[model samples]
Target: MTIHTGHPFADPDPDPARRLRGRVVGAVTLWTAGDRADRTGLTVTSLMVALGPEPRVLALLDPDSDLLAGVRETGRAVVQVLTWGDRQLAEAFAGTAPAPGGPFRQAEFVATSYGPRLATTTTYADVSLVGEREVGWSVEVEATLDAIIVGDDADRPLLHRRGRFHTI
Candidate 1:
């Protein structure tokens, strides 16, 4: 296997928008949907939470991702925050690293009403799809927060920026 020691997308002429996005640090989250019989997940960093009478989550998901398909089919999903220790899990879900027997097999998971949640995750949100629209090259998903669990800030949150993982 060819091991790359440098940035994977180190190009002479990179997309300005992608380059700009890379500079914005974001917490890594794993969004999972579907049931035990059929499940799919994706590592997401481009997301935001809006608070109001009804709190909602806004996430930019790949148009063709299985996670997106599962969410559409099930109408519910679990969004769990990943810790620094979950770097490998995040990479596996992101499809940037090899995952033997699939990414779900790489770690322990607990089934919830929405879907499977990482067993080690202390912070997560159960959401139901509110709406969606095509935004840029991605599908912007809007989901209402049905439930939320906030954990104490003991462990560092996994972050992504500049095509690399960081902890803060």
Candidate 2:
């Protein structure tokens, strides 16, 4: 059977009017230091690339989101790049069925200067929140990278695309 996907067009940044349109893809992680030293996190369906290696990461959070308060109070955050096997961990932190009960006992993790973060799946980086700006439905945060956790087997990455995870 022939599938009909609409016409494909060239992606171009023509002018101011045609600009500002953004595409959504992937499951970039949202993490913060919770009330305790435990890490509080969520899987944001919508994540964006604020800019490149002055290395700023931006996320939009609901005004009353649990993590919104976490970021505001802590002024620091961590972003973990997930692998496919990490779907469960992401779901847990995102408050899915088996929510994070206490300090993420089920998964492997390590204690950091700011908080505890996942030790499984892949890499993580600690970032310091520099500022925030209101943007319609959510707030845009600017953060700087401070520390990085790398593992020997972290070369392969799991990516979320069109609502599923695949090896990359």
- Candidate 2, run of 10 with poorest lDDT: 15-24
Tens-digit lDDT string for candidate 2 (1-168): 765575445444444432432323565463756544435666665565455567666666666666767777777766777766777776666666485564276576666665557766456778787888888767777777777666666555555554455566
Off by over 4 Å in 2: 1-23, 35-39, 48-53, 100-103, 150-156
Candidate that scores best on TM-score: 1
Each prediction's TM-score against the native? 0.93, 0.68
lDDT per residue for candidate 1 within 1-168, as digits (tens), equals: 889898876786878998899999999999999889999999999999999999999999999999999999999999999999999999999999999999999999999889999999999999999999999999999999999999999999999999899996
Give the lowest summed-lDDT range of ten residues in model 1.
6-15
